[model samples]
Target: MKKNPQQTIPFNWPHMTGKELFYIAEAHFNGRLAGDGPFTKRCHAWLEERTGCSKALLTHSCTAALEMAALLLDIQPGDEVIMPSYTFVSTANAFVLRGGVPVFVDIREDTLNLDERLIEAAITPRTRAIAPVHYAGVACEMDAIMAIAHRHELKVVEDAAQGVMSTYKGRALGSIGHFGAYSFHETKNVISGEGGALLVNDPASAARAEVIREKGTDRSRFFRGEVDKYTWQEVGSSFLPGELIAAFLWAQFEEADRVTRQRLVSWERYHALLEPFERNGVLRRPIVPEGCVHNGHMYYILLSKDFDRQHLLDEFKRNDISSVFHYVPLHSSPAGLRYGRTHGGALDVTDTQSAALVRLPLWVGLTHAQQDRVVEVVGSLTR
Candidate 1:
């Protein structure tokens, strides 16, 4: 067998703006390899300026940020946090680590986000927060969700891990909630290898967020001359990434807009090329509601009930194209079963959508030729 002439396309490629090495070198020369150095401050400023967050504390990973949110909210044993079962493990694990019960909710068939309508019915006296994950960077119905939280006085944590440059009705995704988290993993629109940020929207939580990221100390305050000295003040952990990661991130931040634009170009091309398949009843394309601006974080398609999704994926493999499935509903996973319970009797929609959806290769710098190969392979397989 001979290798195909068509170039190999990966699911994701971390984009760079040509300044990463320069900044990393600068950080090393500045002699601050630890967290909260000059580069870290610049990254913090970028996040605050971009998202309008009152304060943004960079963390080692999105999981750490979510865990910090759980801690900041004072989630205690037996307390309940309502969230969709379709989300990642970290979404539930963060709360579960604090001994909080994850009351799982079903996701909307359209956006695959937590259904806002079902939230009120699922709330109980023990419910403390509502963690709404912005699936695929398209926001949940935040207006309705926010109203429900206001009525019940529950905290809202926006898991905007995939939504750095996305918005809903002119408001940034993470800025709408009390606490929001973003990821800069290699797979995300932004890349810091493995990094995340915790956005504190409430002004009151800004100081505490800083302390939490610095291992339960007021070191940040002391650095700012707000305190005479630093000491461990609360139960916390080392969540901040070293300055090297921040230095690399600063480069990405500089070109964040351009990176998002490039990804959007690829996303639109996929949507356009595949519309005929959608019209022919071969597949269904992603939907972006009006006023909701997504970051083109991913491009996925859904197959009809009669279609064998695995068969299509196998076809792509045979054609020398790479495609992959999305998440396995967390509620059905072992940890989810042990630490959580579902709001509805059966999460039928979640299970069905999970089975049908397949994510196509998408990333910045995906050439037209490569995209054409993907579109051609998909068209032939579906037709």
Candidate 2:
């Protein structure tokens, strides 16, 4: 009997910076495995220094971070928040959990981010905030979005889950909005298995943001000797991640630049090799506008009308290569239709992109041969 071939390629493989376990041991030996310990503080400092946010609070997950943002904004019943529909359920669910409505707008054709131009039209008297998801680590037109928010006197929460180590016009993605969230999930360029951070950019919300992460208490101030004793302050949750997760993340943070560079090498290789496919109109490639530096968080292509998106995904799976389709436009989902309402007009761009986008295997340390194999399988399927 012959053994079956293993799945040679994966959609994502978490990268280790060679110091994760050592730091984990250090964290354990340091006698604190809980949240807001030494390792956790280090992670917070790292984020604040890097992104220049007023405060960076580590969360158990990006979802939790978004929930914190929703709380910080005080989103109330009947309030509406404008955002793109082509995003993860968390983007809408966070606001919905607060009894706030999500106004789903269409995305841009090229970058697939929320159309900044359409954001204004979605605003109404009930609008409380604008949540712009930085899809694929490529930013939304934040300058325009910020201006609109200012004009409407609304808050801005950036869903920058894929925007870690990414920037827009010389500023960090998460640091631009009043609040921002980042995912350090195993699938992201950075990894702590399942971790995230909420960046409090607006100074006015800084103190309350801390209270919210500490389960509606002022424990952070107590720990820092800012107050004699802490008590219930506001609506909040237990959003802090454990010290071990931060320990693992600290090791990766030490090598973020190198890790990002390696991913870019793979991303560029895929873009170059797939050029012939793009030229032949076999597919459409990702669009990176000028001045917006993405973190190579993903490498995806849009299948042309001639190609079947599902067929390509199936072919990759059969060939021991892993590929995947991205989000299913939230507006079309059952929960979306019930809890959220579509704004601006038709969701043509969101609908088409959702059906066509297929993300290729992109991970740090992916060998050239493995990448070529992925390309070969895609080409074979397209042909």
Q: Model 2 over residues 274-312: C-alpha lDDT tens digits?
A: 999999898999999998999999999999987888788
Structure candidate 2, residue pairs in collision: none
For residues 1-383, write the lDDT of model 1, one tens digit per residue.
64333467777777788999999999899898999999889999999898899998999999999999999999999999999998888999999999999998888898999989899999999999999999999999999999999999999999999999999999888899999999999999989999999999999999888888888999988989988999999989999999999999999999999988999999999999999889989888998888899999999999888788888888888877789998899889998899998997898888988899999999888888988888887777655
Model 1, stretches more than 4 Å misplaced? Answer: 1-6
CA shift of 255, model 2, Å: 0.6
Stretches of candidate 2 off by over 4 Å are: 1-7
Give the TM-score (vs. native) of candidate 1: 0.97
Error of 2 at 16 (Å): 1.0
